[model samples]
Target: MGRREIPLDPSAGPVQQLAHALRELRAKAGGPTYRAMAGRSVFSASSLAHAASGRALPSLPLALAYVEACGGDRQEWEARWEAAGRELARSPRDDDGADPPYRGLVCFGQADRELFFGRDDLVDRVVDLMGRRRFVALVGASGSGKSSLLRAGILPALRERPEGAPRLAAVRVTTPGGRHTSEHAARLTTVPAASTEDVLLVVDQFEEVFTLCPERDRFLDLLLTALDEHSRLRVVIAVRADFLGRCAQHPGLAAALRDATVVVGAMSAAELREAVVKPAANAGLIVERALTARIVEETVQEPGGLPLMSHALLETWRRRRGRALTEEMYEAAGGIRGAVATTAEDLFRRLTPSQAGTARRILLRLITPGEGTEDTRRPTDRAELDAASPETAAVLEQLVRARLLTLDGCRVDLAHEALISAWPRYRAWIDQERERLRLHRRLTDDARTWVEHDRDPDTLYRGSRLAAAADAFAGEARQALSSPEAAFLDAGTAARDHESRQTARAARRLRSLTIALSVLLFVALSASLLAWNQGRSSGPRPRFARSGPCLFPPRPTSPVKTALPGP
Candidate 1:
């Protein structure tokens, strides 16, 4: 018998399916060309065509939109699209550090162990600086690994405290307004109040003191002073670069930090390979050289420079469904946001239908009423959560486990902005909520003002009603006002102080004017009395003048004398 051959259909691949779907959608769009749809969708026609032409698969959202435009079943198209996406995502990239929370998994080669790599000179410099100056400040942008380097590298090195060394301690001040310095002092004084020169105080996330808790500034200032006064204590602070401007606004802090600052940028290609790739290889993942190069190239791309890029890559690897990661897989994942969203969505999809709804409600409530930011204020009370059904609590627990959200103490927040920005559905919910919040804020402000200003029973009654309406809104606003929001609170306090000073000055001036007017009245009365006395002494008084001028008069006598003389 002749060999039997199975022919593969050209359109069977994801790219072909995407292209076919696009063509069908375009035809149904009643649009002659890609340009027409582009006008409607805000994406270039050529890009859309490329996405649908089987050369590349369309993003899930775009595919859904195209299917809807074509009068196709969106649910059906979405299922197909997701299936295709997963298939394409099976290919793994050959990078050593294909893990979450890092960048350029393959940039650094094999010699780059976590214990040693591109940081030799920098570490030595840091050590030298520490020897020379007890206080050293490390400054970098968020996700630049300032915290990583300090805790992972320097602190570990210092823990041994060489045979003759004094004590060394590391404390992470995560809470902005929380008691940090006292905590530090307490930690230091636990054993004994020893010589001042015996300890190293490493303060991590120092920017939170300014950004999340300005109330802590005085405490931090005192901490800084204590560090300076105590000869034995060495101080090291790590802060985000963005907050440097804020720090500068504080002349005292900016000056203190000016002498010691370090900026972290993307690692060199070699360093990246060492930091990322080699470690993964040690973990037994077989990474291809080409994939490593591709990852490096993508990691260096604009907006892809974040360490979070590594997190996406790692997640993509984990979601490969036991398949190898390839270039096609990478493209199907829709870059970093898509990868993040896909992972989150996968986790979310695992929940029962009811649980999913509960999760959605929790997110909806947590989001700003209108503006779009991932971080929301922690819910003030269980009533806030009770506002959601009991199912929400269960869903929230699930979300925390999924790493989509973080639960710190009683507060819950999205893990990272990338997660929010990655998912269209999530972003949309946040937008709608933000708008709701904005309107609520406006109403709340109006109602609160009415209540504050009127202070009348009737007005208070009306204002209270409005305020009750505003309560939901105020609660949302409070939720929106979180870690970063606290930075603005300082500005608000300054403005309030200025207004109070102006009002007090006005009151003082009014009081002085009233006193001056009273003194002038007293002087005028005394002068009038003196003038009356003088007049009485200088001239003949009326007969009734013994008491005061009265009816009896000397005029009559003068008149009679003149008449007699004339006669």
Candidate 2:
């Protein structure tokens, strides 16, 4: 049998290098076609072909399968994969730091503990509240380091536990969102406490219960019940401060807020300085004194402005001429007010027009309704986007890793709602479609109600309401509607069109009746006039004045029965 030839790009970076190595293994096996390999292996033939295509790196499963099929050493291939990952991570970005010191839009994780600063007092207060109370609510403005404090500060502090202090056992962190509030609450209540000393349930983004989940009160009720049922479980919830009024509506949470609510506000000037100065110092970079003073002076009045400061620092670091941060770099990043928008807009403009359009759509999709009925961040699945287009897929990954969009598991979301209003481009996009989105939101709510009522059809949008939704459902917003909403709108539209046709038929019948009535009246008037004319001409002229028609005349009574007398 003849051997099939496959070309390789030798100097095309680590990805191509890995592809070359894979092809060599195949060549050693007499270069079997992808079809033959798929027949033997579990991986698909197209997947196998793409793995060796020298375009991008293959996933571990595909790579491992290829290595095994070609009989390469597993240990060696795994090591190569690790090396590729390292090289890819270190690959220089357009901004020059793929792993920048500052995180933009994304919250700091445990791994980013060192990078998280400025919330020392807030964290301590929360820790104190948690120490004294069984239930503690950490409420803060969005982008005010609520998640960072919980993950980086409180959790770590609890783990340290002052040695032999109730010995931390099982700790689970979850968000109450998207059809999982009950399940998440269940995790807290149904903990395996026998194996552990105490269970810690850290619920981050607790506001999601109200914003994303429908049975919010039910979930809250269940949570209160769980607290009563479980002794070892200590719960800590982090909710955005904007939703405090929403929290008050839930009696259990409102009662909990009677004492245990910890409000996190903007960090003081000194703290903001530490936040900016320390992270760079740890990263072995220095900020100019003038820059620090300028930042602190400008940021003092701006409440909940830590994100702006951090993002500006990140972009400034990217534009750093050397070890020292400069004034020009900060300006180029659009300064404090414009840093996030500037960077985001820059990323957007750099994309091809089509890809740029796709990016807009992806960002808009991340926006779900907020507690205050404003647009807020919603985690969307990455698979919802078409990965078939390599360009679109690449942009999705880029935006996410850039921290402009936050990705967790297979899901993705805007890191914060602040981005919606902070960025001019995003703000304009939202403003342009505000009316449409409003209608879409109403439709979504009504449709959900309809389903909750077992598709009761009355909740469906009809007439102008359906028309409005359909009109707004154009372009990208069209795809944003849930399946139920789209179905409701469709059914409503059909119903409205049918009603319109029936109305048109009724109008046509009324027009015909009106025309017949007018014709009968005209015929009656003509007959009456003819009878009077005959009487005036056949009978005497009443011996009146010589006029074409007698104005006033007397009739001869004796000649009234002329026909009868003749008979």
Candidate 3:
């Protein structure tokens, strides 16, 4: 009634051995067609047949379902399936040189549109909002896939516009880094008057404007003004949800975001399935159903787990056997929670002592320590790195190759903010030096301000602030400082020392003057007392003399010498 079952050779391999065992179990229960077993179980007939085909190991659930359908012991079959999985994991496989389907700790770009999935509905809603409103804010938590949605979802949809929609003249995306200025905003927001097609501008990581950029208000004003003045200009800004309050500080920007904000939340189970399966399928690979279920179950419970899921999937893909990504590989890659930290720790262990120290400095420099919010990735200029040192450059190269850091032209930053919280060693580094990092951030800002003001003396650190900077940045910590920051600290310290020397000289002069004045005052008092004593002895004498001739002498006698002689 059904196609002949493929014969299995028990001595071939673990897969074949398991397949043969499954067939014997079926025979013991009185052989039945896969269709009959499928009717008794939840799996399809094709899947039941494939489990015994011995082409590859079926997922544990599928294998157990087959066993139970054939009146076999599910517990025994599960053990057999697990044993086969272990044997398969141990077998070495050659690299296929295929590109990974997932973007680990990195946002999807236009080129990755095919591999990006699961945000279809949200993307449509955002596209509709963008079409209706001239300004829209995409708000979501860190690692929530907002950037990926914008780049891989909305950008592609906009380019492939539906019939009767306004054609876009240009679609420009920019991030406002620490140095974004009003001039930069103006350049980004400007629209040609002669151009008839609508222009779409996306500002990704818009929170950076509030956190890093000094001219945040001006940048917001320019964007808002562009929207108000040009009917053809549409602006979308993707910001971390925590920064919505900061955006509200500007009334105009707040009003625009009120009705036009798209919130990216946790992906549903079905969406997560699509996100996990579709990418692997596109790459001609199979993600085991059990692995998919496990990933969905674990990731759904964790808020902001999209990036972690992507990274874990990427790591698992790296360890995949043949064309199948299995649970064994996922576990070997440390699952979702441990995957990132494991990779980071592995890289750290592989580095030399000097290289490890440089790696620490390099990684620490790529983060912007949050004030009231979570820490974020800071894009540093390659020039800012100690690339001159061969060891430092090697560390940077290693990190980039490992996908922990990304190098974009002259800029370098962590591939994602997830790395800051995902890796325990990195997180510990941040926590242990949080106060120092804050001080360094201030020192950096002050240094830039000083340089901008032509190295004004008044801008340099002084007094207690200078002392704090000096203390915190001493020894190895000083290696983290940028050229400008080091220069700023050096200049400030020099100025402070100069002031100290002048104060010491002035103090010495004042002390000498005080001692000299004290000696003169003592000498003058002694001389005045001596003059008074001399005057008293010379000018003042007793006006009366007494004679002791009788028991009672006459009072006030002009001369008492005769009376004294007679007595």
Off by over 4 Å in 1: 1-124, 160-197, 320-334, 348-390, 407-413, 420-567
TM-score of candidate 1 to 2 decimals: 0.53
TM-score ranking, high to low: 3, 2, 1
> Least accurate stretch of 10 residues (summed lDDT) in model 3?
88-97
Query: How do the predictions measure up, each by TM-score?
Result: 0.53, 0.66, 0.78
Q: Give candidate 2 misplaced runs (Cα > 4 Å).
A: 1-98, 163-167, 226-230, 369-374, 383-392, 442-465, 474-488, 491-567
Task: Give the candidate number with the greatest TM-score.
Answer: 3
Return the lDDT, model 3, position 258: 80
Models, CA RMSD each: 15.8, 14.8, 10.2
Clashing pairs in 2: none
Task: Score candidate 3 by TM-score against the native.
Answer: 0.78
lDDT of 1 by residue, 390-446 (tens): 676777877776566766667666554345555677876666666555544343334
Each candidate's lDDT (Cα)?
A: 0.55, 0.74, 0.86
lDDT string, candidate 3, 180-242, tens digits = 567766665566778778777789999989777888777777788645663667788999998
Decide which is better by lDDT, 1 or 3. 3
In Å, residue 512's CA in model 3 sits off its true spot by: 1.3
Q: Considering TM-score, which of the candidate structures 1 and 3 is the better prediction for this target?
A: 3
Clashing pairs in 3: none
In terms of lDDT, which candidate is strongest?
3
